[model samples]
Target: MIERFYLKEFLTFKEADLEFHPGLVVFTGPSGSGKSILMRSILASVGLDSVEAQICESSVTWMIDEERYGLQNESLNTFRHVKKEKTRYFINNQSTSKSSMESISSTYLRHLSLKDYSDFDPSAILKIIDERISARSPQYAGILENHRVKFAEFKILSDQLRSIEEKEKHLSELKEFALYEIGKIDAIKPTVGEDEELNLIKKQLSKKEKIETVIAQAQGIFSFESHVSSALGMLEVDSAFFDDAMNELHSIIESSLERMEELEEVSVESVLDRIEQISELKRRYGSVEEALEYRKQKALELESYETMEHSKSDLIKQISAIKAILETSAKELSLKRHAILGETLEKLNGYLGMLYLREATLNLEPCELNASGEDKAVLGLAGTKLDKLSSGEFNRLRLALLALGVESMNGGGGVLMLDEIDANLSGEESMSVAKVLRHLSSRYQIFVISHQPQLTSMGQQHFLIYKDDESRVRELDDAERIDEIARIISGDSVSEEARGFARDLFERARGL
Candidate 1:
């Protein structure tokens, strides 16, 4: 609930500061007196709307969850909005994004106007039903949560089954493709580094003829070695050394000649063809090693495809088991909701009757299980859909829903702002709406703009928005309230009868 709110330098209103209370806080003034603008300014401070203003601030108090909002151990938070060229929002005097401010504000503030569809959202309707159900039995809370969990699991499994079933329709074709890929690579019979080895062999074969010619010339040098040794013997000095040197030369030349013989056996064409084969494999699969790896991968894929039927059978069994659990949980949830749903409808209709709507048939019907639950709620008023009702009926209906949820709301409740909620309503209808709001005030901090004297007179805190030369807001004293209520009753000119009536209304409200 907002403890206080202030607007400064906004349109029509130069400055206004108002303290709020727990009950219905009504802002009453003539039309075009900047009441809506003031409410908008307050909304802007909470990041709910945009306003051209110098400053807007609101002080709120609620139980703080440190884990959720990243807030410290404090219950009171101050939100401020400053609009210049760009609007800036802050929480607790720390600079923050507007979205963050809005998120935190949403917990304790529900600014429901007449046209809000949030109360009719599927999730919200389900929440109301669940809240009322839980109020009746705590066990249903765990049951509902478990059912929701199972529903999520079922959805995931269903999606997975659909995907696998679709893929399995082409299982035979996929398996055959995997086999064909493996076969293409297996026929190559690639080995790691085979291309490099073949290239080296090809280089050696290319140099084979030149190597043989060099070997023949080297053997001729060995042939001259005998003559050199004979000449050395005539000198009679180091002929043994010359023979040793000649033996070394002969060994080196014989090794070279043997290598040439080895090259003669190697076919250059065969080496080239082998290199080309390895090169082709490299081009296709990146490398000889990678080609072998691909073959292994495809073999594994083919194995998985071969075993797909067994895997699918296992999955089907798991899905069937979970489906049983889902069916039981959904049915149990549906039963519990149906059991409490009648009570909820009765309470809603009770509120509707209080709000002066007599002929409304509201019911919750079981539907196929989805995320929310196995039921859908429908509201019909006098044989027409609730949405097709007049703005007056719709707003009153929304108020009725709010009154039903007040005791069941989980948190410390929220601030509810109603703009001209009693404008088109009859006097009795306006009083009924005010009474309902007064009841809701036990749980929600209500801010209502009204031209109705009954609603204005019922305010726990009443402020008057007026435009003299400029717009201004002031809390109405007891006597001041009489004048204001009288003004609202008679409009622009307060007569003696209007004053008497306004006094009686205030006196009657106080007596209540």
Candidate 2:
């Protein structure tokens, strides 16, 4: 619940601080006295509206999950928004992102003015019906869950079957391509590292003459080895060490000459052709190893194409089986929904009857399987689409749904901000709406703007928005409330008769 709201430089409100209480809080004034501006500023403070204001702040006292908002345990929290050249949002004085502020504020605040469409959503309608069923019949709830799961599986299989059928039209062409690619790779039989081996051989063959010259020079050194041994044998200082050194040098020279001889047999053209073979495969498939992997994949694809007729038949069978299951489950779920539709509509009419509105109609019909279900629900008011209803009628119908659905809620209800919900309503109808709202206030914290004296009398906390040179807002004292309601009853001038009626209305509301 919002405990306080403050606005600065926001339209007609230069600076205003309004304290609020739970239950129905109403703001009443003449038409041009900034009632809507105050509501917009409060919405902006909670990240629900974009308003040009220097500052908009709200102090809320509700049991919130501190961890979810990344805060320590606290009973009261302040949300502040300031708009300069760019708007900045803050929670507990710590700057945060706009989305984060929206996410947290949405849990506690709901602004349902003229344009909210959530009440008319088909999926939302189905969810409300399911919540009712779940509360009364847990077994039916499990059945609905099962049906939803099976329908999801059916959608997946149906999509896969459609894709495979599209591919099946070109099966023969796909088979031929896969086989051609596999055969092309197999023809080369390319091996990893074969390119490097061939390059090494090609390098040796390219420098064959230089290698031969080096081997000849090394052979000359071996000739000097025998002369060195003879001199060392005569000196007798270390003839064994000198002979060992000369033998090792001669061994290395002989190995070089042998290698040079081997190069004579190597054909540079053959080595170049082998390297080109592997390089061509690399150009097509990134690397030799990748080419081999591609060949393996295409081989499997070719095998699948060979037996595609049987696979296609199996897929058709699977789709038919899933479709049959989906249809049966969808019908059962539809029946259960329709079973509750009459009760829901009857209860809705009770609320609408009090509000002096026409009854709403529920239409459940078949649709192709979707993520939501195979049933499409359409809610109509007085034989007309919900979107075509008048704003007053639409808002009252939404309130009716809220009345029926609040019991199914899992957590504390959110704050409801209604902009002149009693506009265009008759005196009795306005009182009925006030009565329903006051009842709903047990679950939701309601803030409403009202032009009707009956609705204003129902407020637990009332504020009068008035304009002198500039617009301002102040909590109405008991005597002030009577004057305000009397003004609302009899226009700009308050008459003695209107005051008497206003007093009686306040007295009656207080008794209720």
Candidate 3:
């Protein structure tokens, strides 16, 4: 239940704050007095869409233990358009997200009316019955959760299987392409340093003849004896005076002669053999670096292909196992749904009678199991389907569903918001709806927007929404509420007959 609501800079409402209490609370006013606008603001602050107006600031406070009926924690604020495009949400003064606020708020507050009756949807019908029937059983919640999990898993696997099957026709071709590319890289047999080695060999081969010629010229220069012969001839002629110099010069020439002979013995065959080896390497490997890279790639491909078959087999097995589990879970869920059909039908029948339909029947039919469950609800009046019923009849059927929801809720009931739901109802029918709402209020916090005297009179806390000068405001006061109801009855002229009717309705409702 919303303990309080604060609005600022909202449509037709510059600033307004209202406190809500348990039991029926009514908002009454003349048409176009900003009643619906105020309601819309409250809904927007709680994460619902606004009517072409952004919520500048809004806050809602709820009771803590009130979570069982759907209120989990207390106090939520939504601040928007403060300084940027982002909107800020808070729960208990702690900053949160809009999604979180929406999820938590939905637990405690359920906005329902003739325009939106999701509780009456066929998919929700079974869950409602189960919540009531299994209220005392701890195992019931666990069972339902288990069923939900199993159903979710089943859906995921089914989707995956379908996707895989769709792609299966191309699997063989894809595998073949992968294999061919992997094989081509594997046969290259490259090595890391092979490119550098091959390049060095190629260079040597290109300069081989030049290198050999240079070596031969240096050997020939050293082998020549003419310079030594000339130096010996000069020493012999000056032997007496230059004996020491001549002997030293002769020793040097003899040592030079010995080195020249040794150099001439060096083999050219060894150099040619080294060049040939390098040429052979370059031809075979293309380049040493490329060879090494090729080897690494080939190794990786071999490892991948070695395990491909096993991995594919495992995936297939997993898909099959999940399918089996899903089938079993879906079967169990279907059975539970079938079992609850009778109770669901009986409750709808009761509400129909209260709704002024003397001969109404709710029929249950089996449907294929989906995520929400399998039983479908079909309403009939004197054996005719509800779609064939008039608009008024449709609204009444919706009322019946609301009544059923009220009966089924556990512990502290949910907060219900009704927006002119009794608009087309007759005086007696309006009274009946009001009575049901009043009874529901014992376990819930209810806020109603109504023009009907029956509903307005039954409000335990009545708030009148009206325009003052140029602004709209809501105030809680008995005199104001009476005047508002009187206006609704007489249409801007509070005649004696309208006042009397309002007084009588209030008296009768107070007795309830």
TM-scores for all candidates: the values are: 0.75, 0.81, 0.64
Model 3 per-residue lDDT tens digits across residues 1-512: 66677776655767777777789989877777788887777776666544444443444444433343233453443333221355565555556566655665677787774345464566666666667656655576666677677668767756766655654566666557656654554444334554455455455555656755665565554444556556767776533444565556557656655544544554446445644554454565555455445545755655655665565566678757855665666566557655766776776777777767756565557667565445565555675565576666666666566667667666776677878868888988887788778877888888888888888989999888777654466665666666667777888879988888887777777787
TM-score for candidate 2: 0.81
lDDT of 2 by residue, 75-119 (tens): 678888988889998878888777877888887888888568987
In model 2, which residue pairs have backbone atoms overlapping below 3 Å? none
For all candidates in order, the CA lDDT equals: 0.82, 0.84, 0.65
Worst 10 residues of 3 by lDDT: 75-84
> Candidate 3, which segments miss by more than 4 Å at Cα?
9-12, 51-56, 61-120, 136-140, 153-168, 189-340, 357-364, 367-395, 411-415, 439-444, 478-487, 490-501
Model 1 residue 120 distance off true place after TM-score fit, in angstroms: 3.2
| TM-score of model 1 (CA atoms) | 0.75
Which run of 10 residues does model 2 get worst, by summed lDDT?
Answer: 64-73
Q: Rank the candidates by lDDT, best first.
A: 2, 1, 3
In terms of TM-score, which candidate is strongest?
2
Q: What lDDT is reached at residue 379 by model 3?
A: 51
| Residue-level lDDT tens digits of model 1 in 114-171 | 4777777656777888888788789988887877787778778778778778878998
Q: Who wins the lDDT comparison?
A: 2
